[model samples]
Target: MNVPVHVLKGAGGKAAEQMAAMGIETVKDLLFYFPFRYEDFSIRRLEEVQHEERVTLQGTVHSLPELRFFGKKKSRLTVRVLVDGFLVQAIFFNQPFLKRQIELGQHLIFHGKFDKHRLMIQGAIVKNAQSDGAFEPVYPLKGDVKLVSLRKWISQAYKDYGDEIEELLPESLLESYKLIPRAEACYFLHFPQDMAKFKQAKRRMVYEELLMFQLKMQYFRKQTRESTDGKEKSWPAEKVNSFVEALPFPLTAAQSRVLEEILKDLNSPYRMNRLLQGDVGSGKTVIAAIALYAAVNAGYQGALMVPTEILAEQHSASLKELFAGYPVTIGHLSGSSKVKERRETLEKLASGEIDIIIGTHALIQEGVDFHQLGLVITDEQHRFGVAQRRVLREKGIRPDVLFMTATPIPRTLAITAFGDMDVSTIDEMPKGRKPVETYWAKPDTLPRVLKFIDKQVSMGHQAYVICPLIEESDKLDVQNAIDLHRQIQEVLPHLHTGLMHGRLHSDEKEEVMKEFAENKVQILVSTTVVEVGVNVPNATAMVIYDANRFGLSQLHQLRGRVGRGSDQAYCILLADPKSDSGKERMAIMTETNDGFELSQRDLELRGPGDFFGVKQSGLPQMKVADIVEDFRTLEVARQDAAKLVASEAFWKSEIYAPLRQALEEEGVFRKERID
Candidate 1:
């Protein structure tokens, strides 16, 4: 089964090359390459055939085949077949040699779209008449790989190496799940007798794929908990309560609960790998601050890494104010840090003078070093890659990690993407916070929308005018940042407006954001760069142009920019979407303010591939199972895998040898350690 695909008959040279291009290198690979769909060619009687229906029928030739040439290398072959005492014309295009295969009084079969009114079958596939017809497997093709050759080669592989494909699951699991043998499922996937059998085979394959994936995830989680040792920090509860009481605002109930969970992990013996997720303005940073306080109190340094420089600066200022009276010393590092300041921060961090360090990716550079790191917190966790987080962790002795993300991930995605980490969600907002009111307006309503912004600004509030593109493009009719900035200044000439986008230098963006925060710029026209970092509590109005061009999660994040203050906030969406899906997205944005709901809807609309970039997320590419559609199966597999991996005897038992072998073959060990 492991032999090269070229060993199969008629699968050498060009065929082998094409198969390799499709990721089928060996006979086993060819067998496991499932078809995307099946063409229903089941034989049906003449009386049962309907007009324009695709079907197969057994018949005998009633007339000599005629070949007619139309143009260069183009010809038509026609024959009359007698089917159950009725004559029907069968036509084959571009197959002139088929005239010799069909003759008068010859028994044959035809599979094609039947035209009952004309008693003709067009584009017919002629075969020697058989008692029964089969459902043909339709595979995804590459290059000039012919479907017939693929079918023949697959059939040959099945005949020659069928016995080598053994059952992977044990009898107990098979009986409990009502699953067929591995070999039978593989065979039926390519040559199913009926739709029922095909569905059964598909269920088995999907279950196996999900089960294996979940088992490996469970195994890695077990390894992380049992193999690695973590610091058990014992901070003073009274001191923590005092620090919390000194804060300007009280912690929400959700934030309190999540903080309790994090504290428990900090005190545990194993290194903690937890994910802290919440909606916008949910006070996640406050919880991180308290956790860092505990780490610092435990006599170990802490590090907070964010995506952009603006966020790092915002967090630095806020955390400083939050810990103003405390004895903890905090330092900031970034790509644009001055030489003297960076050198001083590095010296302080190395000399144990700084208790907590905060920065962007610069915190992971070689020049930076921690005195005695204990806790690692990553803000906007998805923006950084797995390798970056690992490098920061390697600075300490298996420090406990907490990942913070504003993007609320769906449950299915959370399990698959962050399967190895314990998840804590801050679902409640701080008391007295108002939900941003969302509205959809057409381009023709710009005057009224601008008037609304002007009113908000008159009340000592600020506004953000978000555009999809940084500059004008001939291919797109949407508004650009620069042009929109100019237009806004022209329309509201008295209002002070500024421009910000990704193309601007980092320092420029930082200055623009600082001005916006300080209310110097009444209206800031910018691109999506402000989607994550900027925190302007005084900004109460957000106007988004071409809102339909963004996803639900993005629209929700953009809306979060405002509504931070006590005053009411408004988000005006300017879009006239032509497609039904785009219109639905706009409507959904206006219907709910819950980030989790929006994320689920986004998953449904865009699927897992687009909702989360699977390539960037470091998730396995599943060939059979979909995390969204097959969530129930995934749940079952997760539970079963967790139970099986927990049993001490299961790991050493020979009965599970095949399962272990499959895991090894998948290179599960080589996969990056989950955080």
Candidate 2:
């Protein structure tokens, strides 16, 4: 099983290199590399054949192969075959080399779509009729690797090392779940006898993959819970309550509840690994502020890490304003901080003078040190990587970690991606805030939309006209910021219009955002760069051009830019969607303002990969299990894995030896940790 793939038959030279490119380095990798799809080659009679139906036919060649050249090294190979007493033309494209293998009166099997009107088969492939299986496994190929070579090599590997593949799941689990054995699964997955057996094989593999992933999550959760170095900080009820009471507005019930949960985690002996999720303008910042104040009141310094410098500055300003009249000292740090200011801030931070420091990725740099750092809060938590968060947390001795995201993650993703952490959501809006009213319109209504924006701006409120692209693309017939900005200015030349996109320098973007926030730019036309970290309370009207080009979460986030203030806000989606999904997205946006519900809908529309970016969240890329499609199965696997991890049998019993060894090999559990 440990043998190199290069040593396998027909895989010695460039084929080995290509297989390595496909991530097949060892015999084990080859065996476990499952097929993406299977083609049914079950024999079908002419009487049962339907037009354009994919069918496999066995025949004897009635005529010699004729090869003809076409455009750019392409060729057409055709032969007349006798199938079920009828003469049919079999055609293959770009396989002129097969003419050498074809002969008169040779028996052949062809698999492709049948055209009854033409009495022909658009042959995808032609093989010797001696092939055994009723189904063909099609593997994902890369480089110059062909499907035939992969099938041949995988078959060789299975024949050589099939029984050596060890079963990772315990015997009790196998019996309870009725899962097929590991070797049998590998066989069926690579070579299926029938659809029923193939499905069974796939189920076992999917469950196994999800189970292992959950076990790793539960193990880390167990480690985090079992750690003894967590700081059991004192919750100064008097100071916290005083600060809360001093606020201008009362905390919403949801905010109060989430704050209470955080305070409880802070007071407990266990480390707080909690996720704070709320919709845009849902007052999550205030909850984080209260938590930071509590951390300071406990005589420990705190840190707030954001994704961008602008957000860092915004957080610092908001936090400082909230902590006014208190003894807490707030410091701001970023990559753009002046040399002298940074030096002083670092010195103060090290000497325990700054109670709370707000910064971007600069907070996790090597030179930055925390003075008794007891609380670590990361805003827009998904924007940061696991290692970055870990480095910030490692600055202190088991500091309680609070992660905040304005993008409301669908519950399925929250459980599968952040399964190891506790989650708290603030679904309710504050007292006087109004929900942004959304509308969808056709391109012909653009004149009316512009008139509306002009009216809003005249009424002392600003507006944002969002475009999907920065420059007009010949490929996509959508509006771009540059041209849209020019056109908007041409239409309403009197309004002070500002343009901001991702291409602008950080300082330039900041300047544009500043001008917009200060109401100097009444109408800001830009791209999706303003989809996050831009808070403009006075901007009451948002016009999204080509709104169908964006995802639901993104459209929701853009709409959130407005309606932050007490004034009623309106969002107009200018879209002429041609597809059902695009129309559905626009309809969903106008239907409700609940981010959570929209997120669930978004998950169904666009799978987990595109929902808030799956890769950026550091989620394990599974081979078989889909967190979206297989959410119920994921829930079951999570529960079962948690049960197993909680029991001593998983670590001690001989029956679980294979499971432990498998996990250990994956680095899910180290030997020393288990011991």
Which window of 10 residues has the lowest lDDT sum in candidate 2?
Answer: 666-675
For model 1, residues 1-675, the per-residue Cα lDDT tens digits are 999999998889988898899999999999998888777767789999889988888888898998999979988888999999999999999998898777788888778899999999999987656545567789999999988888899999999998899788888889999998889989999999898999889899999999998988898888777764898898889999999988887888899899999999998888988999999999999999999999999889999999999999899999999899899998999999999999999999999999999999999999798889999999999899888988998998678999999999999988888887789999887888889999988877988888988999999999999989999999988899999999899999999999999999888988888888888899999999989988899999999998878999999999999999889999999988575657999999889999999999999899877876766675777876788989999999999999989997568888888998888887776764554
> What value of lDDT does candidate 2 attain over all alpha carbons?
0.88
lDDT of 1: 0.90
Which prediction has the highest TM-score against the true structure? 1
Cα RMSD (angstroms) for every candidate in the order listed = 5.9, 5.0
Candidate 1 weakest lDDT stretch, 10 residues: 127-136
Q: In model 2, which runs have C-alpha deviations exceeding 4 angstroms? A: 41-133, 579-581, 670-675
Best by lDDT: 1
Q: Which pairs in model 1 have colliding backbones?
A: none
lDDT of each: 0.90, 0.88
